[model samples]
Target chain A: MSMLKITDLNVYYGSIHAVKGVSFEVEEGEIVTLIGANGAGKSTTLNTVAGLLRPRSGSIEFEGKSLVGVPAHKMVSRGIALCPEGRRIFQDMTVRENLEMGAFTRTEEESLEMRKRVYESFPRLKERRTQAGGTLSGGEQQMLAMGRALMSKPKLMMLDEPSMGLAPILVQEIFDIIKELNAQGTTILLVEQNASMALSIANRAYVLETGRVSMSGDANELLHDERVRKAYLGG
Target chain B: MGFLTNLINGVSLGSVYAIIALGYTMVYGIAKMLNFAHGDVIMVGGYICFVCMNNLGLPVAVAILLSIVGCTCLGMVVERAAYKPLREAPSLAVLITAIGVSYFLQNSALLIWGADPKVFKSVVDLPSLKFFEGQLVVGPINIVTALTCVLIMVSLTLFTSRTKMGKAMRACSEDKGAAQLMGINVNTTISMVFAIGSGLAAIAGVLLCSTYPTLMPTTGSLPGIKAFTAAVIGGIGSIPGAALGGVLLGIIEIFAKAYIGTQLADAIVFGVLIVMLLIRPAGLLGKEIHEKV
Candidate 1:
């Protein structure tokens, strides 16, 4: 069943139409990926779904309920969490505090359980729980960002550019974590500039270009597609 | 004996400034706006307490509690009405609007209460305390004010460090967009910051009026500026920095008034700020922020 469905979404930043009539769906327990080059509106689409940006016109239905005009904070309570682009973790706060912030909508008992689960998934986070977030290495920060999002116990977790600026090995590790998370029952909607790695793990893929979804299909088919190879795979 | 008296007086006054400075620091930290009207909130708090205690004939404790509630609401109202609409506007625009609010509050007080200063009756009626074979003396107000400030500082520290709402506040201060994405209500968090800041201002107001015993439209102006300076001195966004700055500013102002001429006291305070800024631009307790390109 489709957990999140977006239909004919249009988003604007000032006069520029950033996401123009984009539509997509994330099925339950499937890893869906949006891949594109810079300025392709992939982030914009993700943000719109997360309710960070209001669409000019579109229908966003999460669990069959319309999400138009819903505030960004309310999205989390609705079981949708976005790990925003650039891993915007609170630098001044401790790692534990950042994770705690992720459980803002949750009760104390639920938060404690979530914290234990997050710690289990990312042992490094458990080790560095007392350290300030800003002091963490880029890879650790990325992990913390994802871990922080996980603290919400989201059904549909949206990750934007999770591998940006990381070493190849760290990037591989992040993808592994992503795949592991998907296998563990979190429905994932990923936005990425690393088309090759993203397509490898995704069940389905959508190619966003200049503010619209230009191509989409089974991830495996798109990986071997000549058009995708020529445009995104640097062939 | 005179030195001891001056030390006690400085600490008592400094504690009041510290309380007020907490308001400035917290509001600036979370909202990223210097609420120029914060000082006026102090005046309004004083007025509210006055009306409740004198006009309404409520108990002192009840009057003080009502003043806090009044200020907290006022702070939230000010944020929603004046600041929220201009959230995305330029900092200068917000600053100007804050100044406008400050003037509006001052003028409103002037129109309602008149320009003439009225004597404020002391709420705490405890007799003075003596120590060291009656050589050293202390007013009950001084002890109460100092202890209250310390208690408040500790409680605020615990609140910001331990509570979920406090963590949300810290997150909001760091990144509003990110905080919202985390399912933390950014609007509610901002309102909470305003409420906390204004509540602190109300307490400072009552303590200040108790000592100084004067009520006027501009009652909070000087102390407000001093508290702002204190916040900047300690570190505008750092909580401990604000407290430290307030105490240092208080001591400096008191010493200047005693030894250096009264006219040069303000000058000395500003001069100290200048020197401190020159030495450490981030203020004393403020963490140095590296701008990410």
Candidate 2:
């Protein structure tokens, strides 16, 4: 069974339908990527899955349990976490505080234990744990956001545009961490505009256009597809 | 000698303002609402403590505690009934609703307690402190108010920094949506802030009444406005700023009353606010986040 599944998801932002009948799945221990253009509902879909936005009609199943109406705060305990777009780290809070808030659903001991693991995964955050999150550089802030999500020890981690405002080297480093975390058993659902880099690391890929899935296949197959190359691969 | 006396009185009055200002600043910080009814909540707290002591004949400590709990519940209810539903509404709408709630509390108090003013008995029983051969005098209530205000400030600082719930409050203040995604019940955190802010209002009410020895439905309005001015002077959402603004306003008010004409004291106090705003619109300690964003 898939670790996460959504069937016929229809989400609306007022009169605008953001995600129309979008169905997708992320199996355990696999890296799945959703590549799309601007305003194609990639972020909206990820947000709906993370429970930030309620779908007007659809079913969201996580580990075979329905997540249709679960409030966003309760999603952490259900073994899912979203590293939101734009790295929404608390500016006034210290890095450690940011991570503590991420692990808020867990016990103090578990939070502390997970802190150690997150530090192991992203050592940069540990160095600046005492500093406020806003003081960090762009790359460091992204790392902090990702590290914070990992503090929950989520079974499935969804990242939304993690590489949007980072340097090429930083983007490569972040993708490496994503691949490494997947190797360590956390399923990954990634959304990115950098289709080439995303597809290179993803086990499978889905192309979304105007709120609907345009194509889905093994990442490498789509990477070499003639139509995929012309449209998204900058032909 | 006269200056010294006024300074002591100023500090005492300032301390009460500090307590109320703290509450104002905190609710503004976490919930981002002006909570105009906060002063009315103070009026309610004063009435509760008065009833508990005068009618029920409860001890002063228990009376104060009951007042705190009552105000806390009232604060939460006010949030749920008036503020929560309008969470997505424009802030102006919320502001209007707050003003309506304020009037509601005031009228309710008037109906329940009547228009007659009650003489409040001082809760503090300690002897007055004397210095300079009794030429300099400080009431026990003065000392107690200052001490209690200090204690509350220290505890509040520690609570927000050290405890998990406190951290949650800080997180909610920063970004509610992000905080929720971190597994925090945003509504619960906001409600807790209201509870705390209202609890502080009880203490402020008691302190104000203890010092003045009068109880009326409209008693909290003047001091409430003054404390809000103090909060603004210090920087509305900044904690220590509230204390500073409260003490400054208190000192200024006392000096104006003692030296200048008594009727002009309030005018002078408000004049200072206008001047402060003209010079530093962000208040003394408020960050420039409001700068033309």
Residue A90 lDDT (model 1): 94
**Candidate 2 stretches greater than 4 Å from native:** B290-293
Residues A30-80 of candidate 1: C-alpha lDDT, one tens digit per residue:
999999999999998888888888899989999999998999989999998
- Candidate 2 chain B weakest ten by summed lDDT: B284-293
The C-alpha lDDT values of all candidates are: 0.93, 0.93
Q: Among these predicted structures, which one has the highest lDDT?
A: 2
Question: Which window of ten consecutive residues has the lowest lDDT sum in model 1 chain B?
Answer: B118-127
Pairs clashing within candidate 2:
none
- Look at candidate 1 and tell me the lDDT of residue B289: 77
Candidate 1: residue A166 Cα off by (Å): 1.0
lDDT of 1 by residue, B38-121 (tens): 998999999999999898999999999999999999999999999999988999999999999999999999999899987877
Docking band of candidate 2 = high
